[model samples]
Target: MDTRERLIESTRELLWERGYVGVSPKAIQQRADAGQGSMYHHFASKEALAAEAIGRSAEQLRAAAETQLSGPGTAVERIGAYLRREREVLRGCPIGRLTQDPEVMAIPALRAPVEQTLAWIRSRLARVLAEGREQGEFSSRLDPDATAAMIIATLQGGYVLARAAGTTEPFDQAVTGTLALIDANVAE
Candidate 1:
């Protein structure tokens, strides 16, 4: 690939592997096999490159979620599909991981994409819950927004738990348990 594309891709991979605080421009340049001048020419600074990488990652995540969200199924079914979708549980959610980075969150531009990515996922879940209510699949009393937040939180937290334990068991259990809870709440 070209220097610009290589730089962005390298940054994305490094960001996922090392996080915002851990990654450096020099490392990115080395990973990209591009010189300092090439990288800086494309991105004004490390933060600028990271911002672009985060934005790209966010877009990719949203697109993946939309695939499951728009598929043919009931609300819970679609959500289950999303939760069960293949992922690198050990690697963690690229966007979610950014939330743990003080450097990324401290910068408004860097944080925006991360925040928007998570908010979109939560909003999508809430919309699904709303649809379930309209279709008599869920109780009218169930709070869509709250439920959505809980679901997203469970997934995000699952990653943290799994990472801490150095195993995928916690992540799998979290999904299983969360799905069971959702199923239990569904209208019989």
Candidate 2:
């Protein structure tokens, strides 16, 4: 691949592995096998390169989520499809992980993509819940926004628990529990 693409890909991988504080420009250059001058020519600095990489990851995630959200099915079915979507639970959500990075949170430009990505996912899920209510697929008492937040929080927190436990079981358990709750709320 070209130097620019190589650099961005390297940054993305490193960001996923080491996070913002743990990754450095030299490390990215080495990983990409590109020299300092080449990297600098393409990116003003490491932060700028990371920003671009994060943006790409965010866009990719949004697109993947849209596939499930727009699919033919009841709202709960589509949401279940999304929550059960194959994921590297141990590696964690790239966008969600950024929320824990001090450097990322300190910079608005760097944080925007991450925030927007999660917000979009949550909003999409909320819309699905609303649709389910309209169709009487869900109980009338269900609160879409609150339930959406809980669902997203559970997913994000599941990643944290799984990463700490060094296994995917915690993540699976969390998804199962969440699905059970949704099922309980579904209209018979």
* Residue lDDT tens for model 2, 67-124: 9988999998899999999998999998999999999999988999999999999999
lDDT of 2 at 171: 97
TM-score of 2: 0.97
Across 1-188, the per-residue lDDT of candidate 1 in tens digits comes to 99999999999999999998899889999999999999999999999999999999999999999999889989998999999999899999999998889999999999999998899999999999899988999977878999899999999999999999999999999999989988878986
lDDT of each: 0.93, 0.94
Measured with C-alpha atoms, the lDDT of residue 100 in candidate 2 is 94
Residue range with the least summed lDDT across 10 consecutive positions in model 1: 179-188
Q: Which residue pairs collide, candidate 1?
A: none
